[model samples]
Target: MRRLLFIIIGLLSLVACKTDKTSVPQDFECFNQPHIYIKYKQPINGYTVKVMWLQNGEVGNALFCLEKQEVQYYYFTEKWTDKILYDKGNTYPNNTVIELDYTTKLKSEEYLSDDSPFFFSDVDFDGKEEFIINRYKSGSRESNAYDVYNVTPYGYFIQKTEAPFTELENGQCKFDSENKTITIYGSNGWNNIINKTYQLKDEKFELIK
Candidate 1:
């Protein structure tokens, strides 16, 4: 009887652990993270290959990646910013190359799809296309949340802050150009397929029926 009791307790423990991983409250906010914006995209090889970066604000370091490898790092400060002396010895939009430290290269499985990094849509019906960027590595069962970015009607990027934006944990989202909404579909948990619709309100996404 003691052996049977031990086995039952073990099973119960596993179930509780799994519930912790899979459980998400109905009103939980998904994109509650700090705003990280892709600052630049420049081609290193051909059009198919390029370099890009994302920075938090005027404080955090900028993460630069070539292909799937993080090849450089930069801090967002006047000291470092002033060191960017020239725009390739030219002008703005051309890009100023800066010295950067090399970071570890990503393995083969670390790469996302070719077009996976960017999704463009006008979720607010403002006639301006908003870009949604994600770092979802291909073939991974997890790592399925969003890196939300919505550009302004003028030309500034803004982060979307709202609750229940899709299932948040496992929802794979797509922008519906026709309806001006973001449709996310995935499993809530335990083989339950969940679908959600969201529309932009005051620039952030809000859940809608």
Candidate 2:
């Protein structure tokens, strides 16, 4: 009888441990995490990825990668000013970027998982930070594709799709802020390697020696 009781207790303990992992803890600080990660499972091929990174206590930006669709971008402010809903078909017209609210009751997986490839940095040496998200890495060469955005003073994201920014799509960047230059390392064709340097000039990237 005691052996059966011990087995029952062990099963109960296993159930309890699983319950803990799946639910949000009561003391979770929703807005002030490293990066907000919320996963919403879909009924079909894949799930949606919603990630918002807070630069300060007040403002940040978010990226939405819905399956089979172009990735959408939005910015947020004052923590609760923008509320991002997980459901589809909500409308924002004219293809302009909008503000997404930062309201989420879901427990963030930021602490449970490793840091994602999302962050804010001063990539232009303009003393203002830019947002960078590494969308994916290509095969073998591990070429990294990036979405780099310049944040406006009014909390907007203007995507930089020009020269050096375009160069960053398939290569890794090492920024030298003091020298105001970017060194790129990437491959052109199979078995052909390239190392190039570019200087940040007039808010543009110019290829130099």
Candidate 3:
């Protein structure tokens, strides 16, 4: 009887462990819903500029801001230096400035000059925004790379790409609401590329050749 009771207790423990592993919480729901339209505001040049979030997609405005002082100096000196001052007011009118401390995973204290424009857009229709970030390497021109992020409603970048690449150049992206298509065209290498249309519904890119 003692051995039978011990075996029953062990079986009960195993069953409990299996239940714990497979149980789903009451409030758990899959996060696959489409995003609604949203807007954000920031202080620019003593006034406020309103930036709107993309609807049914990911990707927002390009962020243009003064790099933090220590970071700016590091980029120029190539050595880690703490001697620098950050000027906030010396910025272009149409340029959008965002705080690196707020959005990115990188530590703000390590870098130098940070005054590069980070381009971002909703290239994929996945209701999440992607970033074109600028990084100051040791000896290269300030590098531009692409990143993706799942942002919150309060303008915070949540999940981001682990690695980013610098393949595409800067250009304007326009979406056709009527046909659910996107048109991207600008500079590619030395020549001016034009009229590259992407059909959103079909997920195909057609280059006018």
Candidate 4:
């Protein structure tokens, strides 16, 4: 009876250990301002974690909590010194924290420099610059996927996911106003390079070959 009791207690301890290993953490900083972009890698409870978030007015916000293989220690402000780096491949099991409509006044302490991920450029040739954000990193060539939000005449942001915008992912773009074309060039993955040119007509993109 004594041996059997000890075995049962040991099994219960093992189960508790497993449960703790897979448990997710809950504490994190939340922002309410638009165009908020934060990126940092740090260690928490023996695991390496990467945090990244970007917010836009009306359109929404996105956050990523990635698990990295190696642990890195970073100073709070000094961590913002480097430009954003693209991921080499898919990350481990991770979490995402979303703050959809944080509508608070901008605080001075939460201010980020021009190293933000948001910008504006005219992709549809409408004589107005559209809102653009470097959404995610993809491919082995350090290319990025972009989110293009067209600015309406009434000052509203509408996301465009059709051609030209869809095909522009995982690459770098160059806009030519004279030729009325948008050129995207970058590596697709390990072997292939992407170089596609598209012309805008009637607010749509047509492949120019």
Q: Rank the candidates by lDDT, best first.
A: 2, 4, 1, 3
Q: Write the per-residue lDDT of candidate 4 for residues 81-183, one digit (tens) a residue.
A: 1123212222222223322221221332321113334445566777766655444332234344565666555444456767667555432567677787878
* Tens digits of lDDT, candidate 1, 1-209: 43344345434333333343455456542212222223334432211222222222222222322232433211111101111222224222212343322221133232212224334444446665544443432213734343444554443345555553323332355656466676766566878987778876686667795
Better of 2 and 3 by lDDT: 2
Give the winner by TM-score: 2
Model 1, CA-based lDDT: 0.37
Q: lDDT per prediction?
A: 0.37, 0.46, 0.31, 0.43
Backbone clashes, each candidate: 0, 4, 8, 0
Q: How far is candidate 3 from the true structure (C-alpha RMSD, Å)?
A: 20.5
RMSD of each: 19.7, 19.6, 20.5, 17.6
Give lDDT tens digits, candidate 3, residues 1-209. Answer: 43344345434333333343354445532121111211123332222222211112112221122222222100001111111102232222222333222222233331212333233445445544453343222222323223333434444343342211112322244555456555654455567655556554454444332
TM-score-wise, the better of 1 and 4 is 4
Candidate 4: clashing pairs of residues: none
Which of 2 and 4 is ahead in lDDT?
2
Lowest summed lDDT window (length 10), candidate 4: 73-82
Residue 34 local lDDT, model 1: 26
Cα lDDT tens digits, model 2, 10-110, are: 34333333443355457643322333433443311222434333322322333333233443333221222122322342433212233333223133321
Arranged by TM-score, best first: 2, 4, 1, 3
